[model samples]
Target: MLASPLIEFIAREHPAFVHVPLGLVAALPLAILISFLTKHARPLTGTAFFIAAVGWASSVASLVSGLLWGRQVNLIPVTGYFPVVASEKQVLQKMLQLHITASLVGFVIGGLCTWLLWRAWRREDSPGFAERRHAGRRFWERGAGVPALVVALLWLGSWGFSGKLGGIMVFGNEETNKAAADADRAKRNDAEADLPIRALDYASLEPAGAAPERSKAHGDRWRRIWVTASGIDDYQAGKPMKPGAYAVMATFTDEKGKPGTEPGPLYMKETKADGSTAFLFYWARVPENLRKEVGGQDSVYWRSPDPKLITCLGCHEKDATPAK
Candidate 1:
């Protein structure tokens, strides 16, 4: 997954690549104006050259950002995942990589074009300012320059579209969430900070009809769990869990492995909602009833709100606080 460096780069590069090119387009006309008004296009030449330089730099940065983001998202398929039936995923990968590579080439060529335009604007050997202005226009004349311009512009437009999706990857989608994952983590960190050293009375800790909730030292016990979703940052998928979020739910038992009021396996199920879907979940009260283990992948998490992967699907819906 892409990390903070790449994420920040993307957030900054999109806007820069978008606006910088317009300066070049405008500066060409400015060259003609300056020449006619003041008998010289020298200032316009410098302005156009500087803008082109900056534009080229930003363009390359955008190209790199897009590709890195592509790899982060697994936009490219494994060579043998599915058969030769290509999907939109393949098409998107090809288009994105093509634009990224093409943009770099454009940056280089756009630079030379700017330099040429600069030289043309600086040409003032003509009889009068009017004649010099005509010379400035010819400076923009390039060998297949218009076609290259089309490529650059088209690549930039494609960059914008890619950027929209990339933004979703770097920053978590907020519409599914009531608040940010980091904000949820903050609440959990606050909870951990307030965790009492000695256990409180179990009855006092829980509300009526709620099974007693207690905490023991995590003591670095790792559990197996699947990663439901992942992205470059904590915000995207798992951020909702909250800080110090992991917890274990092994069933409580007597020596005979009978039920007791201790930890147990988390059970979850779906609830029907008016439009789409919802969830309900609770702790399994009987230790013997637990399956001994819930199968999961070996997942490494960032600073997360939900540790222990407690938010198992179809199980803990009843236990979760309102997802605010």
Candidate 2:
């Protein structure tokens, strides 16, 4: 889901907002340790409670903003709690999964620690608290103080680890940088990359018709034709596309005898300098029910000279055709 501008701004500020809770939580262990040694334990215990409560509360904002930021970056799926780490090569995704897990664990631990402190604070402030014989004992040995301290330490450790992972993600590590560069090089070497790009952005060309029309030769799908400036007049006149010009046909699956909301494959034909035609068929996302049409693949990209495009060449033997 797309977030509002205000929410997007908050998500972008996640790095800044996280420091508030982290700083508070980092100081919590010190305050609790001091409370154990102080003669005036009640005041120090109250201060510890205040710090825990505020830190746990502020963590909510940090968690929410982090989730939003993760979605914005596509590291986490829109509806997923964790990113899919399918292989060892997915270094960044693996790090993100660990980071999210650590943050959640810390948040839960912090909540329990805060509650413990709150209970301890209430007992220390009770009217009969001074009269009790246990009141003379050290704060760590009394009530929930020691347990809260232990849990607080665990919380700190989890958040500290999570923060380390977050840092690596923001500032790429050796492994991450190398993986990114390799991926970029692979993409550049991929031959279908530019063809898929042009097919996806076919709308930038001039439209041959105001609305889509059903194409009987193209599986009865609704298709709208778009042509380059050099080929628009010729395409409208049923003449062959001139050299260096191309035409794209954007298709939609049928729905109740009309164009469905689901997008179908994009078909493109370009006339080369040698006067030969090149064809491209691209579908970024194929509907599940229609995956069989493309050999069960969820997406497809085929260009001229590939045996896969023989069907396209068979139909447009000479030039682009208007949808029937």
Candidate 3:
């Protein structure tokens, strides 16, 4: 059976709901701390309870929405499998764990604080309240003031960390994650840095009057586009293309030409490296995952370990020249 629209909607809208609880939880602790510093517990008791109550309630809603959303997206699969993007699974899983765990912790801490504040209010009305054994105060109650402060701090800290993790997952990878690809990128960057850097002159690729070639390809049907600039003369004449030569390949979708769904980051292929050709891409609009892969800086000229033909084989293989 198909999932409920409401659940899917919640999943799609989790970002919106998640923030409400984060804000409420953050404010609850601040209010409690201010009451302690001011020594004005009486006036702030009701306000603390009010904020805690709302924060707890919203946290419950946020947790429920997150679970339902997970189910909707198969993040927490109920039955059938839902495919995630190949490169994103690990980061997504980590964020999911953090979000759920922290929200539960927040709920528990908020509930306890609310109950203590209620008791504090009740004690204010007892006879000789200020000195009545500090009275009728249990051992735990005697030190409740400090513990309350500690719990509030934990609630704030956990919720904030969880929210930050969620933001990274939604926006892209975080800096500290240890993905294998990241290591590979570092190795590749070090290698590329040692090689000569050459800029391809776009207008010179094709003959002065020749128009650029264009075609549609890719499983998703992204358009296959290219212009042959300079440095391939030997390969064109049945010899190995010299190193440091250049060409440009651009992909576009039929619906929107020029800037396809994924556009720019023009790729420059050098003739040879490590017994195979090498490509360096200058990103116009960086891929979301790429930011994390490169340690937060969107540097130009990403080097791909995979060969150009294999990468573009889906459409360009048929037109490729045979190796000498």
Candidate 4:
């Protein structure tokens, strides 16, 4: 779903807000334990109540922010990797359910305990209610406090797991890319270190239109393609790159930077493994780094073992040749 600019900004900044509540709630159990160990029970209980109230408010804020952020995310699997089209949808729903259930339940329990503590404090303030205050204090400190602590612990665990799953969903592909590289290190090394020196005239090649200039493919970077003479020919003819030597280069600029100035990375696709053609992807910041990596070979760069990891396939597979 397309998110509004305000929603997008909040979603992008959700991580920072989430940690605040998580930290506040996490400190509650330790404070309770210490209050029991020492005799500073009255002050600690008031502090715990205040912390719980703030934590509850912050948790609500974070949850709302996360939902707003989720609007921009693809919760449903677009590819047929899942058993059902809504498998990811189901998983996300469950995570949200667990997180919400744990948080609200903990908040309610902590709130009840806070009220009990407040009542105890009020009794202590009333004149000639020493015995009543002592009884109220014992009831809350010895009884309600234990359950509240347990609920806080459970909430922490539930939220931690939910956050872990969310992180895996977002950044998990890097692990897959690393595994592929490890599985075929020799092939990857050869592809990166030894592609043919088929350079394209970056200055002369026609720049890709605005449609292909922006993507989340390179993690919030601006990408512009500068195709080779042969690449342009194949693209015009609605054919793949001919099963021969040639290079296609892409220059990445920071999201706000100009086309060539402050270029972040250089992506080069070269023909590798001939006979019904396959292309390998290479990347580097400067030609010097590429040369150093490949033993002083110019145009040498580190190849992407999995193109999807580096988001090369989305454009290359679709836009390189027009579909019938």
Candidate that would win on TM-score:
2
What lDDT does model 4 reach?
A: 0.53
Q: How close to the true structure is residue 134 of candidate 1, measured as C-alpha lDDT?
A: 41
Residue 195, model 2: lDDT of 57
Q: Provide the TM-score for each candidate, comma-separated.
A: 0.34, 0.64, 0.46, 0.42
What Cα-based lDDT does every candidate model obtain?
0.38, 0.83, 0.56, 0.53
- Give the winner by lDDT: 3 or 4: 3
Candidate ranking (lDDT, best to worst): 2, 3, 4, 1
lDDT of 3 at 10: 67
The candidate that wins on lDDT is 2
Candidate 4 structure quality by residue, lDDT tens digits, 95-205: 545544555565565566556545544544456644444345554454225655676667667666666655654455565445445647755665334642433345566
What shift in Å separates residue 235 of candidate 1 from its native position after superposition? Answer: 46
User: For candidate 4, what is the total of clashing residue pairs?
Assistant: 0
What is the lDDT, from 0 to 100, of the residue 211 in candidate 1?
44
What lDDT would candidate 1 get against the real structure? 0.38
**Who is ahead in lDDT, 2 or 3?**
2
Ordering by TM-score: 2, 3, 4, 1
lDDT (Cα, 0-100) at 322 in candidate 4: 27
- Tens-digit lDDT track for model 3 on 205-309? 543223333443322323332335444465456554455554555444345444346553455555653334555655554556655433343544455442222
Give the per-residue lDDT of model 1 (tens digit) for 51-76: 55566665555565544444444443
